[model samples]
Target: MELKEKLNILADSAKYDASCSSSGSMRKGEIGSAHISGICHSFSADGRCISLLKILLTNVCIFDCKYCLNRRSNNIKRAMFTPEEICTITLNFYKRNYIEGLFLSSGIIKSPDYTMEQIIKTVELLRYKYHFGGYIHAKAIPGANMYLLKKLGSLVDRMSANVELPTEDGLKLLAPDKSSDKVSKIMQYVKNSQNKNFVPAGQSTQMIIGASRETDLDIMQKAEDMYQNYKLKRVFYSAYIPVNQDKCLPSLITPPLKRENRLYETDWLLRYYGFKVSDLLDDDNPNLNILVDPKASWALKHLDEFPKEINKASYQDLLRVPGIGVKSAKRIIKSRQYFRLEFKDLKRMGVVLKRSKYFITCNGKFDLNKEFLKKEFIEANLVLGEKANSSSNIYQLELFHE
Candidate 1:
């Protein structure tokens, strides 16, 4: 097959994996601006990444995962590229300024080990034969042997092990062949290689939201475990789109966006706002609060903890208040050390007094209606501020991607 034909098939197949980013790999004016933040050239029509030349090594899988579109039973077009072809395509794209790097994933062909080896060869060809220094992200197949991961890690910029589903039971129901424990173990192996300089960009994984029967709490717990255990760079959540029918999964038009937003909110809390998964969710609250963002929901539920003295509040203390974010809280911390802040001083510091005022005290005074009559207190109150905002949170993520 021609190289372009191979590119079309490979790129079409790889779209299923969402673990990607060109962030954190900074160079001092060498490889452009270093994207110290990150660079997503554009988002796709479906709101997915189109920055890198993302594609699969092949769509022909030996294993059959029921929820997947590329499974053996799905009867989709199949194509595979040789190592030289992949390396040549990547070099050509990079030279033409068409892409920053490559993102390669694949269906399980022959066996996990065999699929992984082909992936490793493509990247190795890029780095060695073609001398390509551009970024590369590859899949670390779950049950594939770990030694391959170790060698391939040094050749690629980042690697990911797709979690596929949230829970083991969810995995059993949708992808009976997948083992969550085995998958997590591969993540752990990748993580351990950090000191060896195996994968400096760090590992990431993906979870298909609203698929199967797993609750938000269940999904976030796994995310927390991945971050805490594997030190993963990210855990991407793709709101499941029903491209196929299954008796076991939901047949919704789109995965719940609000729930996805809620999870994003909850995820922000876990990574930046000093929250335990147990804090935001419990037996009573099986799913995240659909009405309020998780952070706002938690603050309201623990009302007694609020109305804190912003003038004297520590950095950690300010972050706990409903509306205070890392940036605003830092301003409060720095500004207060110099002067006793009044309500107006907070506004000057760019702190949203409307939301912050209720959760905080300026000179020992709280400004909030005892009735607090906004219909959805979190939105009308928190977002729309009493007003609106997490800088080390979601906005950070959007900026990180942009």
Candidate 2:
């Protein structure tokens, strides 16, 4: 087939992998060209954000991963770009200012080593032959040779080996060919090899949510372990998009976008808010409350700890508040040194007063007028257009966009 045909097929094929941030919009019109056709945005080593030409080396697979569109059993159109062809396309795209980098991933073509070699060759051509100095994020094949990984790491700006599912049982049931141990070993290799010359932007991994019977708590526990063990830069959660008919998978038409968002919120809490996985949920409540964010849920659950004086609270305490972000928390710490903060001052400092007011106090006085029962508070928060509502707005926003 022609290169353009391959590009179209492979680009569409690449969309299923959610390892990078995607501006989920299809802005195709008589105007500018920002349509979501495999063009994705990623951050650079120096924090300069750039768009990447996200595509797959091939969509032909050896292993039959049941959830994947390009599984061996799936009768989908397949395409593979030669390394030279990929380099030429990347260079041409770069010259036209279409993208600043490339994000390359591939299905196992013949073997993991062969696939890795093809990926490496493409990167090599881009770097040496084309003299392309742009960012490249490459996926390391799970059981590929260590030397190929080292070479790929040397060439790419960021490297990731996706932990496709959350738990071992999930992996065994859904992707029996993929070993979690192999993926972990690759992660450890990248973590150990990270230095000035290798993978400067660090390593990240993607996890498929709701793919199996893994609860939100189970996912978070796995995420925490990955962070602590592999020292990953980020654990991206891709809500399971049902594409094939399988007995093992959930029978859902829509992706669990809300659940995915909640997981992200919990991830933010764990990474920045100093929240442990155990602190977010227990055995009784294995899932996150979709109506409210994890932070607000935590605050509501531990009401006795609240009405915390903003002026006296530590940085960690400030982060635990429903609406206080890292920036606002830092601002509060710096601004409180100058004067005693009121609720208005908190608002001025970027704290969301509607949600925080129930859990915080200003100048030793409660801003909450009446005693709100937990049920009432949750209901009030869930009401549309109320300032207390943030998570539910996601559903409205998705509807508006759709």
Candidate 3:
């Protein structure tokens, strides 16, 4: 087939993989440069937007993953790109400024090892033959040979081996061909590799939420384990978009985008805000509150800790407050050393006083009237604020038309 036809087929097939963000790789090359923060329409750590040409090497798979669009049983346009073609397209796109790098993945073309070899050959051509230095994020095929994994890691800036489902039961029920043990081994290999240059951006993985019956707590617990044990840089949550019909899968017409967003928010809290899964969930409440954010929900439940005096609270304490972020909390720490922080100072430092005022105090005085302190009132306001800030009008409109 022609290159354009192959690109169209494979690119469309690869859209379901959401673990393509690139970061922590910096190299100066003869033709292109990989910035520290780059992904498809994703911002880097320093806040620069970067784009990549995300595509699959081939859509022909040996495994029949029930949630995947390109399963072996599915009737779809199949295509494969030779190593030379991949190099040609990448260089041409880079030269034209159409993309900063490439995010490449593939299905089981022949075997895991064979697929890894093909991916390695394509990236080797770009790295050695063409001297393209742009950011490349590749998927690490589970059960591939260890040597091939190491070689691919050395060549790419970031790598991901998707865990697909949140739990082992979910894996067996929906995707029996995939082994959670193999995925864990891949993550462990990346973490334990002595070579500092192997996957300089570290490794990340994608998990499909809403595909199985796992609760939000189950997912967050799995993510926590990956972060603590594998030292993973990220665990991307892709809400399950049903592409195939199966008796085992949920028969939802729409993807659970809100649950995915809530998971992401909870993930940020676990990573940056020093929150434990136990702090936000329990046996009684195993899922995140869809109405308010995880942080706000947690704060609402623990109202006895509220009205915290901003001047006296620790940095960690400031972080627990509803509206203060890491940057704002640090500012509070630095600014309070010189003078007492009032509501105005908190606002200037980027605190969302609309939410914080209900839970915090400035010099032992609440910013708003005491009437706002009622639990019911605070919860209502938080819900309203979340609804106002949500960008769900498009989804709602589509639902209405349907």
Candidate 4:
């Protein structure tokens, strides 16, 4: 087949593997379709999701991981593009103002080592041979030889290996052919390259949510480890959309988007809000609280910890308050020294007191819950847009965008 025809076949094939940060309801991604979440997020001189000419180098594999459509044993049509062909496509796309670079991934063509070699060659040809320096995002095959990984590390702007599933058991059941250990080792290897922060952009990985019996706790534990140990920029969670659901996978009931959103919120708390994984989950309660954001839930569960004075509170203590985010807490430290803060100043400082009020005290007074008996009443009174109501009540709120 011709290069564009093979490109079409392979790009269509690459969209189903869900390690990407896809947002739109895209059924497939070809050249003209531009909004894939995991590609080269650069813009043209014209601003668009036109950074990377994202495509697969090939769709032929030698391993039959059951969750993957391109698994070796699956009786699907196959295709491969050479390094020269890929260079031609990326250069053509770049010249036409279609993309800034290329995002390349592939199935295991012969062995992990051979596949890694081919993927690396494609990026190196674009970078060295063609003097193309835009941006390249490569997916390093987890079990590929280490030498190839070190070489590819220096060539691309970013790299990833899909964690595929949250738990070892889930991986064993769904993608029985891939290894969590091998994937983790690669993440660590990439992290080790950041001594002088040489690999400045850092690394990221994706986990498949709702694929197995693992809870949000399970996913977050691994995510925490990846952040602490591997120093990953982000650990993406792809909702399991059941492309190849066998009886072994979980029941396909609801769209996994809600659970996916919950995970993203939890991840946000861990990275920015100083939350520990145990703060969200425990040995008894293994799942995240679906009713509130993880921070709010943590605050509600530990009510004895509340009504903290905004004036006397430490930075670490301020972070523990439900509605006070990192940005808001920092602002309070600076602004409060100039004046004794009132209920109005907290709002001006961008604290969402509808969610934050029950947990904090202004000059040692709690208007929202003076009695402090009805946790149910407090929970019920809290509506999402209560801050925007502009009504006069104890729950009247004030906040700003920072």
Clash count, one per candidate: 5, 0, 0, 2
TM-score of each: 0.87, 0.88, 0.94, 0.82
Off by more than 4 A, model 2? 21-50, 370-375, 382-402
Candidate 3: give the clashing pairs: none
Q: State the C-alpha lDDT per candidate.
A: 0.75, 0.81, 0.88, 0.74
lDDT of predicted model 2: 0.81
- Root-mean-square deviation of each candidate, in angstroms? 5.4, 6.6, 3.3, 8.0
Ranking by lDDT: 3, 2, 1, 4
Task: Report the lDDT of model 3 for residue 141.
Answer: 95
Alpha carbon deviation, residue 397, candidate 2 (Å): 15
**Which 10 consecutive positions of candidate 4 have the poorest summed lDDT?**
393-402
- Tens digit per residue, CA lDDT, model 1, 213-329: 788878999899888988988888877767677677777743555567678777788888888999989878888755456777777778777668877777877888766787888
Worst 10 residues of 3 by lDDT: 393-402
Model 3, residue 168: C-alpha shift (Å): 1.0
Candidate 4 backbone collisions, by pair: 51-100, 347-398
Q: Write the per-residue lDDT of candidate 3 for residues 1-402, one digit (tens) a residue.
A: 888999999888988777656567787678998777664555556333447788999999999989999999999989999999998998998888878789999999889999999999999999998888988889999999999999999998888999988899999998889999999999999999825478888899999988899999899999999999999999999989888999998898778887888899999999999999999988799988777899999999899888789999998898999999999999999999999888888899999998888988888899878876899999999888877887775345433543
When sorted by TM-score, best at the front, the candidate numbers are 3, 2, 1, 4
* Candidate that would win on lDDT: 3
Residue-level lDDT of model 4, residues 1-402, one tens digit each, is 887689888877776544333222122222323232444444445222445566788888777776677777677778999999998888888667667566788988878999999998887777667777555668889898999999888776678888878788888887878888899889989988854223345678888777788888889999998899988888888777665656786666444655676689899988987789998898798887544567777877788888789888988889988778899999988888888787898998899886788888889887464775367766655534433453433222111110
